[model samples]
Target: MSISRFDKKIQTPPENPSQNDHSAPEEAAQIGAARVERVIHGGDGLLRLDGKAGFISGVLPGELVSFAVLRDRPRQFEGVLREVLDPSPHRCEPRCPLAGRCGGCDWQYCHSEYQLELKKGIVAENLRRIGKIPLERESIQILAGEPWGYRERVQIHTDHRGRPGFKARRSEEIVLLSNCPVVTEEINRFLEDAASGKILLPPGKRLVLVLADGESPDSRAVIVAPGPQTAQRSLDGLPLSFDPSSFFQANGPLLERLGRELRSRIARDAPRVLVDLYGGAGVLGALAVSGSSAFSGDLLCVEEDRRNARFIEENLLRAGLKEAQIRVVSRSAEKALAVDPVLKNLDPPSSAVILDPPRSGLSATLRRWLKKGPAARLFYVSCNSATLARDLGEILGAYLIQDVTILDFFPQTAHVEVLVELRLKG
Candidate 1:
């Protein structure tokens, strides 16, 4: 389905609902049965209420749902799902008992294959509507893995009673869980042990658990708590050390595949210089420089987080790339890319830049600078499609998208990870 059609049929929530009181009600009231027309980004179902758009959660397209008005505005309304009168054919029994209560997984009720199709539509729709980049559906390759037992890392929150679980949907209240089907068996076992009093956890402290290897839950487990503790892990055969707060890919196997694909792509380009922006722990750079002679010319990693910079240094040294002329700049991508001497000296025709920005996507300063002129080849990794579309729209005039791929890093949820390769226009 075209995004423009959906946009025209459904109105978005007001930027500031308090600006006017045209549809404001003193108290929330029950809205009668509404049929969901389609699913939009962020896993919300779009429907019409009183000739205005209404967004409801825990629903699917073609389902008739009864909802309560949570917030009302002149052109839009927010609702809370009360009951599903008619369900979609793709809907199934959710594995998690707390599916709707916990904010973790939203597409559990929908079939996995259908979820993938919906995600593909979302990516295409976002690119066309927000990015102004129309792409053929067949050109967008979708890569997926086992939908369940794939999460390698998870953060558990503690409640007033010292029980560990995730927060309720859109609220601070904790939903205690004995097991999470989405996480690997190791994490589930750990959760079971913790809840059974076998594992000692202090009250009201968030805990992070990571599996060293993606496949084996028992391989090497790293625990990060609210203290001065460290752990070790290996990605694509490169040893690295990271703290609890460090950023690492949650899916181990898919991360390795992504690394291999990136390395292959970088090797084929034969760039004279490789610059990794928003480099976290320098994993991507390290992977790209592992055995490629083309990247031996120069390698630069720019990161804003001090802790991540230290980890990157330790990782590179551990990888035996000390003589590889690798420079780690501890600064933001916008600042470093703007004035870095190495970037300025690079040969744009034979150079490449790798960008893995945060969910907010590229900053305006960096986007404008890149649009002015950049390396011949650019690789962008984004977790948020909406922001990615917006950024790509601003710079597509200067660069053409050569390839686009979607990685299901997050399954059983509405989130999708996208990787796109762009070539500078002559």
Candidate 2:
């Protein structure tokens, strides 16, 4: 069935209020069986129950499963997997014992190879449905690294007893875990050390661990407490440091690959000026300037957080750009575009802009600006495909989609990072 048909069925109201909300302590009687129609963006399988759309986790497309509805809405019902009557051939046992309970790795039940396929299909569907951009399967590139032990950064939530763990799926309950397999080996070692009293941890509600050098025994990682700390690391031979609170790409190898891709794409565009919006630690800005042989113009990194200015300055300095050539603006993207005189006169043919906004995508003002005054080359790095599609739909009138690449930054989970290249239409 087409996704459009499913959309129509979702709008249909439920026949009875009892079917809409089940507030009883006993919901087992409401269990129903349905074949999963498809997997949606959030990695939930879509199905139909009594002509109403149903969503359940831990199931695959085309699998017949029984589920218990946890929450019911007008159009769709959220459910939990009860029994897999007919499991998919690709199903495999999760590595972690807390697979279904811990919210860290939701797609651990599926094989690594099939996980990429599902993410690609979901991205394509979002582009076609939300962005109105129908892209061929072959044209969408996929780059992935090791499925396990690639994460360089992780957040560990704690309980009242100071036990380190992760939050459970869709609940406030904490799932205590001694170690996570998805993080780097060094991190796991640190966790083991912390658990075994080899290291002491200050009392905090949550802890953020960043592994800069896994091989170094002396100071391989920094265990950032509930305060400000600098996490130092290098990517693709570029020295970098950032506030633990600020954002940084988690996967190492995949991040390096992304750097190479950005450099190559920017070089092809041959932009004289480069602007990095939402520039965290100036990672992308530095990467683009360091490797691009054709890049000659000044580099501008606009970041809203004032605490990141020092890090951005240091990183850009190390990127080989002269001190006079690098400009760091401490302002939001919208404010910078509106107030900064330098950002107002961007040469369409010689300017390149990189957007790495939060999951909400571009601001409304920024979207309007891009649609009217889009640069020659636009590189958008997004973690949410839905927001990316929404932003692209608004700005596609002036920009042509060059290509979209999916990077499996968060393996064993439903999250996928996407990078899109756009060029202004002549």
Candidate 3:
């Protein structure tokens, strides 16, 4: 179990040598070296040192690396990669000079194709290990585009000098940026303009910049900084009104693909009623089932934010769902289900539900309700796989997984968007 033999060029003492001594300070920022056993969900490499499991970012499996322990415990430690004593063959140089410092992207050290492989492996491992759902490696589908310049939305902060930048990794300190490589060209130009004083921005304010359309670089961008002003965008020709602070998908092409996939699945299932949970701007369900000639189902969007009701209604109308029964409930999913008569009387056989909950996944009450087989079909879109696996495991007795697709929404980063289709077990 020792990795000392793997590399002898650099030798360092483990953070803790005594297994039973638990009085060490929590913030033991010590330097140590270990061989990475595997990469985990958040793009950190898992390794063991002195009989204690540890995790360090900016590394890959089989690489012997030195790290600075940010947090040390009796059983485990969290650290940041300091140096690679022995590097993995799949490692590559990051495109951004500030990749290690800026918190914008992780896995920049990993090769592009290897990044996909790591994501697929992480997703499958999470499902198998956490949810007890096992599938062949080839069974999980992956949707990816170019590995760079795909982000349509970016939020930048202004330092005391009004310099726009992103926060450093694991710290509040702003890392000044001359340019960003992962954002769209338009955003990059805008940032450059702002940085060069061509575009004046308030100092010490959070600015949210988003393009009106991802594919059209010529389109105008909507920049908001603490105001009543809002902006409008389109999804598959459906008009969407959103502020810069809106939570729409950042990757445009892959979002369209996700919409198409959901549309095809919902159309094929022919659900008479469609319920969109945690419907942020009513984008997912509205754009998904829109323009489907076979879809004449009633639409219900439940969102806790009442301000989004107008946008939801507007998008639904733009989707040509005027004649169909459409209701926007501005309440949490749990409360909305209890108060709304339609949700209470939903016929599972003729109904479908789209669960795009937050990164925390479904609430316990909602999970319990879903476990009772509330819908015949379920489309669970998740950005966090760990929580997704936990929630899926709770309801597996009632629903069986039919398909799992990994969409590379955030490239050059540890983040991923997953779409899981489930069907009620008869």
Output the number of the lDDT-best candidate: 3
On residues 1-426, what C-alpha lDDT tens digit does candidate 1 reach at each position? 211112122233322221111232445354456788888888788898667788876788888876667677889988766567787899898888887667778788888988888787788889999988888666888778889988888888877666779876666777898799899887888888878878867778777777653336437664645454456667777766666567778887787778778888888877877789888887777766675555555678898888778877777665556646678899998778668898767788888899999899999998887897579889999999999999999998889999989989988898989999999998
Angstrom error at residue 186, model 3: 0.9
Q: Using TM-score as the measure, what is the rank order of every candidate, best first?
A: 2, 3, 1
Off by over 4 Å in 1: 1-28, 213-218, 317-322
lDDT per residue for candidate 2 within 1-426, as digits (tens), equals: 412121121222222211111222342335567888888898888998878898777788878876566677999888666568788998898888887778788888899999998988889889889988888656788989999999888888766656677877666777877789899888888777776667666544778777664346444655564465676678878767777776678897898888888988888868778899888788778877785667778888899887677689899888878888888889999999988877898888888999999989998999999998558989999999999999999899999999899989998988978999998998
Q: Write candidate 3's Cα lDDT for 1-426 as tens digits.
A: 437322332244343321111122344346667898888888877998787888777778898877666577989987656568888999887888887678898778788898888888899889889988886657889989878888888888988877789977667888888689888888888888878888778888888777774445436564554554456677677667765565767887788788889999999888989999888878887778788998887999998876666588877877778845688899999999898998899999998999998899888999998999989999999999989999999999999999998989998988977899999999
Q: Which pairs clash inside model 1?
A: none
- Location of the lowest summed lDDT over 10 successive residues in candidate 3: 16-25
Show where candidate 2 strays beyond 4 Å.
1-28, 213-219
lDDT of each: 0.77, 0.79, 0.80
**Of 2 and 3, the candidate ranking higher by lDDT:** 3
